[model samples]
Target: MTGLSAAAGLGRTSALAVACARDLARHAAEHPGLFPARPFDAGFFHSLGLVGAFGSPWATAGELRAVNRAALWVFAVDLQVDHVAKSREEVAALVGDCLAVAAGDAPRGPLTQCLASLRDDLGADPRWRDQLERMLAAMLKEWDWRESGATPGLEEYLRNADSCGSAFVNLSHWLATGDQWTLANLDLVRAADDEVQRYLRLLNDLTTYDREARWGDANALTLGAGRAEVTERMARHARTAAELIDPLRETSPRTALYLERQVGFNTGFYGVSDYWGEL
Candidate 1:
């Protein structure tokens, strides 16, 4: 594969990662009071679904395993943000764990194996690696303040948050520029379109209670509206991404399969109904 093709693959994975992070943030914002008390136990498999969506099954099982593990650590931080009020030490531990896994210094597992395969396929493609490293660095820096039981300044926090989105943007950029990659083959644009629609429907259903309950009006009015906006943006990004990936899909069956599976997993696992059935 050409450098561009390798980058496209990485971009697809990055897009999914951004989606996962967005969902994580949404969950946190929506139920800030509940997460800290309940300690989000959505189960390993549920979290794995997000990883599977971003990373391909063609990746060694080890890579997938690592991805899942790292996800746990990442989500755990979000879940604990309001609950435990983590001490600096606690926050440091979490950040350290995330970095270790992201850097490939952690033990090899199914997730790691998968990542290795992806890296190998992307041979000499520094863009993806550089982006990944940059994101990791930002995350680590953010954690430094989180460890102190104090939030990072708004600018820093937003920058760190942008890293999550940038992960996908980098992927989209690669797809747009790469020679061997094309939107026709990847169908990325199409998949992203589907995801945006699904996200809107899911958000609407999930927040219906807030729309009706006596005290929920505020939440419904604010969060509900905000979610719609966020989903809309995500939809736009997905289209941009799809335009980049669709053409490459035909050339990369393994990568294509991975993206398809990811969408299914995201829908099935994180679908608002799955978690808020009673609501």
Candidate 2:
């Protein structure tokens, strides 16, 4: 593409990102308590909107809603679990409430209400609830590890990767706008997502180690893994993710590119910035 066309393409994606950001801001307003001003600021919303817009540039804002909403929901849950909840019981209660809403119960609070809205938008994907359960469980387990002052090895820490929430967001995206082959081969797609999730987990840890250390959140480096080791492991996962994604190109080309772009985008984004604003 020439410079002019390249600039035009970016302009279109940026416009889509603006729409996605507006929608996220409206959702945040609906559940004000869930997104405190310190961190869930305007820039954070736009950054997430860009993730959805550029990750799948072919998608319209409406088509991208599930991914954007789900990504926002992850941040809300992360803040609540990592910062707000004072006790394990509180965390467990939050988890139970979300799972209950996922199972069709009435949402008892803003968090679950937000989740209920996402669920309604998602319709029924057979694996959606299962992925939710995995993410929530991983989050609760990490909370326990942090509270107990436990130091898990790199492998173990990566196993708790669902706490990062990438897979859930990807699943929501696929359910919302996936082509038939992508939908039909979800098991395989999920396998690829899981690998990417692990990569993102470490990527996040590497980028936000200082903030995480200050906040007392679990991070591989703080847990005793060396940066060199973490970097090596990330490269390994990236290779595995690429390998898993490569085969899908023949049948689910867009899905393959989506996964590939995730690895590429975050690699660059995390090199200089993060999604959170302050706090």
Candidate 3:
């Protein structure tokens, strides 16, 4: 896809993420006992707070709320995929259902409808639709790996993170500047640039931490043979993500600085660490 088309595709995916997050949060709230003990539901809600505290200034409160919901969806899907491998047939069916819906077929249930809406919204661009289909295919392949009892390769994990992160970045940009680039007001662009950078940093950290945790799990699952290799690969992926974000950070130096301060203050007051202490 062309750069503009690619960007638009990302934005659409971000929108889907937002929608997914919302639905997941609602589901978890309504079915609290179904989740694991580590506050998965609560964590998803907390991630939304992180997004709001670090999101762009030009975005409407409604839009930010949407972003929060989307983030939750992304988290929910990842966790589901991670654990659902235990029941490959069931998970595969869900994955297939998602793919069918994404392909323009009507879903069979309310939950499926929500998933379909998210996918359809994200697939606004024909190219994006194709990309989403490819992503689904990859997800199926990953599921197959799980079914075969193969560890997920570091590259596979990183590719998923990049795709998800790009979607968030695009959504944040769109919220900040709307659809008109040259016509975008300076204040809006500045706000968007700053917010987007902060988000990238947050997501980068989240991805790194998650991968590290996953590697630990992989080590446990594989009886320690894969730990060193997985760690090295995850580290490389983290570095690659950092490199990709540098230019984006450079695009709004002043905004980045302001965002750093904002994040610092916010974290001090209401971050996960702070909550941990309180608990």
Candidates in order have lDDT scores of: 0.42, 0.92, 0.46
RMSD per model, one decimal: 12.3, 0.8, 10.8
Q: How many backbone collisions does model 1 have?
A: 39
Model 1: per-residue Cα lDDT over 1-279, one tens digit each: 999999987776665654554454444444444334243544333444445445453343333433433343333433333224346565455445443544555434332333343344344245445554555455455445434444433233333442332233324333333235433433454344334333333343334545334322112123233455545654664455456546546665444444444445554555443322222
lDDT assessment of candidate 2: 0.92
Minimum summed lDDT over a 10-residue window in model 3 is located at: 270-279
Write the number of the candidate with greater TM-score, choosing between 2 and 3: 2
Alpha carbon deviation, residue 263, candidate 1 (Å): 3.8
Name the TM-score of candidate 3: 0.52
For model 1, the superposed segments whose C-alpha errors exceed 4 Å read 1-64, 77-225, 273-279
Cα lDDT tens digits for candidate 3, 1-279: 799988876576456445544555665565443344353645445445544434443344455543454454444454555553467676677667766776778987544565555555454434334444544555555556545777654444434432333344334324433444312434544333333333443434343444434532222223232445544543454454344434544455434343443344443444333211111
- TM-score for every candidate vs. truth? 0.42, 0.98, 0.52
Sorted on TM-score, best first, the list reads 2, 3, 1
